[model samples]
Target: MDTENCTNLYLQVCQTFLTCKYDDPTTFDDLYKLLPWLRQSLTCCVCANVIVDPMSSTQSHCQHFVCGKCKGGKMILRPQCSWCKDAEVFETNQHLVVLVMCFKKICQLIASSPIYEHILNYDQQRKKELAAMKSDSPAKSDTPSKRKRPQRKFARTYVTSSLLNIPVQQVLQDAMNLKDVDINTQPPTVECKT
Candidate 1:
């Protein structure tokens, strides 16, 4: 990875890691609300789902993305642009690729770890509370001192030295040993057999 890009991605990873409240059930939604752009950026234009393999259309007018599954289905013929409906060629969108790579682990954990029913119940209760707050409040004609302000709530947090899967101490050790490493070389890959 380019050093500049790596630095930026590192910061994002740290932010997500720091924001997460492992013990809190609402951490997923909290992070979702915190990073509003994440959903739109990763969403597939065709299926309205998060793109696992993001491929963008070739047409200058049609830069919209279709996930691998959507494009793969049309691959038997020619892959079509979901938005423009044009018989278009597709290529990996590098920008989205980097974003996906950087955030994918944190996103997967948040989306899959939480129980769906708990999230639904929390949202429903939150809506009801907001509705009650709005309806019970006095008119604007009332003095500012007489009006009550809602208190801001923060998530319960814990102290830890781990960065996702890697320990912070290990990362520090690796950083110090980076001078001996080659940046241009690719890491070794393992082959899988069926």
Candidate 2:
């Protein structure tokens, strides 16, 4: 598939995987927690979401990066830096953009793999159980204060493996190393952080 189409599909699958409520919270928690650092490092300061078309303030001291949405929507840098109070212009941060793209690919791979399919199956089963419980207590259905069942936590490795019913590490390693990706061509200046 084309790059944009592939990205959108991966994002959709990731969204579906995240929304499912697992019976054991750690079934995916340990493995999934590794993905968010990509966003935290390169996201817009204004919207606080993953940066799309990343641009940074031109001021020397505070070159805070902001996403295109924040730049065009609110005019965050009309007169001064919204973050550092300096009058500055926006400049394209190609390095940050490259970094974001690379990490996004890694995340997409993990999200679009067998683990996602496993979650889908588990969510279906969980939904059926919830439906049966609701039917059994019809009077409590309309109550906003209905009690929720407490989910017990299990060992991360054990839970993750049991959920997938497979060798988790081998599958994850295979997913991460799916294709020949050469991100080493990034410019040396890419190391600079916002």
Candidate 3:
């Protein structure tokens, strides 16, 4: 693969490895056994692409790096980021870019390893499962199950109580009196025994 493609693949594998790390700890542990420091670095949060040249609009709020293509596509729709939704006033993250560049060779080597292929297969299988679930759900809804709606033993009837019937005028009078009453003008009610 070309350098750019290799970088992209490395990023994809890294992302999948990290996702497996958090989401499926067992699988992550298995992968971790094969490659320990797989989840130690960052990748583009948007497209799972390698952030060779890291770009971020806001450092304080949205610190995640986005690749150029993803950022450009987002810019077309709106000037806000896909992950952070911050304005598209991005600055080049020189430090992160340099670090990623330095690690490119190592990433390329990892990309060629069997662990990377396993992660890639895992990602594809997960995607297939998701799609199957989505398709199956719509089919399930279309062919509704023959579930009988339960009949109520006693019909629900709402009854108003006449026990504590106060006139609306009395309620309004009380509310108006409350508005007129001032705590500052009221005298204290307590009587001293002495």
Candidate 4:
């Protein structure tokens, strides 16, 4: 198979196998049977780890990389054009293209599922399409919209105890050693007049 088709095929197969999994490890070992080069080609594109799924008679190439569609990256198809984000053309001469296969059919399902038109470098077009999809009636939704939860909100911060209640400008000015005039006192200090 040509590189483009090979990659997309593997991805599609992976997507399919993964999505329809039952609570068993029936075909898990078959995931290791893909071509070695195909295995190395798509490992990094994914951002996180996921459980490897089993494939029946079909071959699976990648098993660990979490599906972008199901995870935080959103649903992007395998064999994404080097130049285009979701281009499905099957040209192999493109030097920038990377062929990949999926052990689970998640990628295939996502790729086939209807989605907003993908555009390259067209921020306005992409934004408009995204907005339209987001607002489209829930009745039109064939896929779920579960966004990954935001990371922990209580990480380390620079707002120290000394400046906890202090104004922002004062804190910034103090950091920069920028002096400010105090308006609360007369001169320095004054005894209360009886």
Candidate 1 lDDT over residue span 67-182, tens digit each: 65686443211243344465346555555555555554444443454433454565577568878999999867544676678752321111011122232222223333322323
Q: Tens digit of lDDT per residue, candidate 4, span 1-194?
A: 23354466466445534553333333322322222223333322332122111111112332223232323232232433233233222112221122221222233332333310111122354357768988994775668668957663222121122223232222222223312223232322346888
The per-model lDDT (C-alpha) reads 0.46, 0.50, 0.42, 0.30
lDDT per residue, candidate 2, 103-193, as tens digits?
A: 5565565556556665455456656886898889747366565677765443333333343433333334333443433445442334557
Clashes of each: 0, 0, 0, 19
Clashing pairs in 3: none
Identify the runs in model 3 with alpha carbons over 4 angstroms from their true place: 1-52, 57-90, 102-106, 139-194
Residue clash pairs of candidate 1 = none
Write down the RMSD of candidate 4 (Cα, Å). Answer: 27.6
Over 4 Å off in model 4, which ranges?
19-22, 35-37, 40-194
Best by lDDT: 2
Better of 2 and 4 by lDDT: 2
> Which clashing pairs does model 2 show?
none
Question: How do the predictions measure up, each by TM-score?
Answer: 0.39, 0.39, 0.34, 0.20
List ranges where model 2 is wrong by over 4 Å: 1-30, 72-83, 118-194
Clash tally for model 1 = 0
Stretches of candidate 1 off by over 4 Å are: 1-32, 72-83, 108-124, 127-194
- Model 2 misses residue 111 by how many Å? 2.2
